[model samples]
Target: MKTLLLAESHPPTLEHLTGLLSQAGYTVRAVSDAVMALEHFSADNPDVVVLGVDLPRVDGQHVVHLIRGHSQG
Candidate 1:
């Protein structure tokens, strides 16, 4: 399965998440901000998006709403 991670800009955690997902045999796409997350969503079309709530520019709840809207409509 594919996983898209919208994680904090902290490098260590981001690296760890990527490593873990890769080890789990997932096709992982990791992005720091919400804009890139949306871009990845359109480009990668991941099966799941793991979003961080304290996101910059656009927050996670808004992302969730947008994804839901896109999925439904």
Candidate 2:
């Protein structure tokens, strides 16, 4: 099964997206903050990442950079 790393600050959006993606058959790991998102990304190494631009603690763009830096792909 494929996995998705979802980093969204809005609670409703997060819940909605998680449900939608889960129904679509992807394993979703959702986080409300960028720091936790990055941590989860490192631990889970998800196949895809869905990020909210406006994030707390760190920001989506930085998280993307971190992922790119660590990822072989």
Summarize candidate 1's per-residue lDDT along 1-73 as a digit string, tens digits. 6565545556677788888888988877888877888778877778878888777889978988888898788
Please count the clashing residue pairs in each candidate, in the order shown. 0, 0
Q: Which ten residues in a row have the lowest lDDT in candidate 2?
A: 64-73
TM-score of each: 0.86, 0.94
Give the alpha carbon lDDT tens digit for every residue of 1-73 in model 2.
8999999999999999999999999999999999999889888989999999999998889888989989866
TM-score of 2: 0.94
* Over 4 Å off, model 2: none
For model 1 the local lDDT of residue 42 reads: 76
Which 10-residue span in candidate 1 carries the lowest summed lDDT?
Answer: 1-10
Candidate 2: which pairs clash?
none
* Best candidate, lDDT: 2
